[model samples]
Target: MSRLLLLSGGLDSTAIAAMTRPDQCLTIDYGQVAAQAEARAAKQVATLLGIHWSMITVPAREVGAGLMTGTATDPQGPPDAAPEWWPFRNQLLITLAAAWGVTRGITVVEVGTVASDGARHLDGTSLFLEAIDHVVASQEGHIRVRAPAAKLGAVELLTTSPVTEDVLAWTHSCHRANLPCGACPGCTKRRETLAAVGLLQ
Candidate 1:
């Protein structure tokens, strides 16, 4: 069965894509602020891994609720929460992937939500994934969701993933824009994690 990977082309998702080597990958542009950069990096990753790369552009800028969408939301969240928590983003992305799976007979939908990611966004939690898995299972098509790297944070990801160096060089994790602003949570985590993993100077 063909498996689909949600490739954000960031450190985490890119690492998963490289490790699992899925048959095909989907890069969604949900009208995010950095969709172009994500798509570019995802395409590169798919090419390098010899996987089919596909883009699904569904504009959702109107419902913007985070820095990624260039909108302002409640800046005050949990201590571990990042400022870029888009509402229902993970659910929407998974649903989109499941819809695509219906057409392609892909039964597996995988994402890259590390343990630390859950601390940042509630949707990234294992409970959310399990619930979504049930939802997918109930749907007509043996589809199920999985997060193989759900337990690993960035540092652990670097240690475990086969494409750590490539992900470091090619992935983009800027919430402000496609070109790493170096100030956003995404950029900071990437930099700090890379440094911790000894991949950065």
Candidate 2:
């Protein structure tokens, strides 16, 4: 089946995008605080990988999610499952990607969600993707959602990818800052993954 990758300009997604070389890469800007940086990074990765780049701009600033609106990231006290989570974000992005894919005769939708993602957000889980794919399949074409890294962390996922250190540097995972805050979960994970893969000291 034809395929399109949901490129988020994050480490996992960028590595996947580079490794898989989808027909095209789609990045959605839901009006997150780092939307501009995300778009730039996604476009750069897509260009470097020789994949066509497209974007969906829905302006989700009013969604009131901390990740999108630039509030606190993990909140206080115990870790909330919804920390840094956007409401139905992956669902919306998957739906949109599938819809856009259909227009181009694409039937496979790939996301960057990794094994650790489910811990922070609901939609990043394989279970959630299966459910959403089931719903999408009902329509026809069996347009399915696939996360190549759904069972692997960043380092493991990139272990077999062609993504080198320089390419990995193109990612932008900061939730609130245009540049990486280095304190947010995204940055911390980015560093951890790089270190795990022996790319960082």
Candidate 3:
């Protein structure tokens, strides 16, 4: 059975994609920061991994109304507070990936959501995965959403996922990654997570 991975060109998703060793991968241009840049990174990583790759565009400005949309990361305050959320991004991404999987005879759709993602992202939770699983199952056994890192914290994922420096080289973790603005929340998170695993400077 073919596995369809949702590639985001971020550390977590890239790690998940590496572990899945999927037959093919799909990524979306959600108009997020570094959208095109991340797409380029995804293509690079997918090629390096010998996985077929395709790209899609999501109307993120239309569907996403959170900090990730560039509105405001933290209308409130604190590091792990208001701006930490991204609405239903994972659900939407998985739903689209599952639909594509069903059409391609791919039974498994790999996602990159991790346990530490709960600090800000609600859709990264098991509940959201369960809900999306039902959505895929409703279409029969054609597709299933898989979150390999969902049970693992960022430290565990970074430490144990089969991602090499080569794959990590293809990542664009900065939320404002035109040139990798390492100051953004996403970059900070990635740096901290990797540093926690002793992989970052």
Candidate 4:
């Protein structure tokens, strides 16, 4: 059976893609502040994985009330206590992914979300996954939503996956794609995570 992965060109999703060894990887561009970065990183990662990939464009021009839309919170800002949470991002992404799966005859749709995301993103929680699974099942299409990294942290994710320094170098976790803007909470957290695992310089 073929599997589909929702890759964002970030460390988490990248690792999940590697672990699942999906037949195909999927990504979306909603013209967010990080759109270019995600595109670049996703391309690099797809090349490394040697998997067929495709992209979709979400029709959202103006910034909505989420980080992906570039209106609610500053994409480059550091992740705050709540991290300017993106409202219903995971639900939207997964819902879209499931729809794609239906068309492609794919039985599985995977995400890279982890437990850490639950603090800020509700859709990243296990409960949300269960909900999506139910939604997908209702189609009677046998589609399943998988999150192999749901229980893992960055450190554990890196160790279990075959990701190397070279692979990581191609990752894009910065909310701002043009430059890392390492001061952002996303960058700071990525740096800290990598450093803790002795992967950072």
Give all candidates' CA lDDT scores: 0.86, 0.82, 0.77, 0.78
> TM-score: which candidate is best?
1
> 1-201 in candidate 1: lDDT tens per residue?
778999998989888887888889999999999999999998988888888999999998776566887766444435555689777889999999999878888989999899988878889899999999999889899699999999887788777888847645878888879899888899899889889988789
Candidate 1: stretches off by over 4 Å: 73-81
lDDT of 3 by residue, 30-72 (tens): 7676777789889998888888999998667555544456666
Candidate 3, residue 174: how far the Cα is off, in Å: 1.7
- Put down candidate 4 lDDT per residue, 1-201, tens digits, no spaces: 778999988888888878878988888886667878887888889889898888888855353344455555553333452444555567777888878778788888989988787776677788988888888778857788889899998778988888777877888887644468786667887898899888777
How does residue 6 of candidate 1 score in lDDT? 94
Task: Please list the residue runs of candidate 3 whose C-alpha ends up more than 4 Å from where it truly belongs after superposition.
Answer: 71-81
Judged by lDDT relative to the true structure, which candidate is superior, 2 or 4?
2
Off by over 4 Å in 4: 61-63, 72-81
> Clashing residue pairs in candidate 1, if any?
none
For every candidate, C-alpha RMSD to the true structure in Å: 2.0, 2.2, 2.7, 3.0
- Against the hidden reference, what TM-scores do the models get? 0.94, 0.92, 0.88, 0.89
- The number of the candidate with the highest lDDT is 1
For candidate 3, give the lDDT. Answer: 0.77
Ordered list by TM-score, greatest first: 1, 2, 4, 3
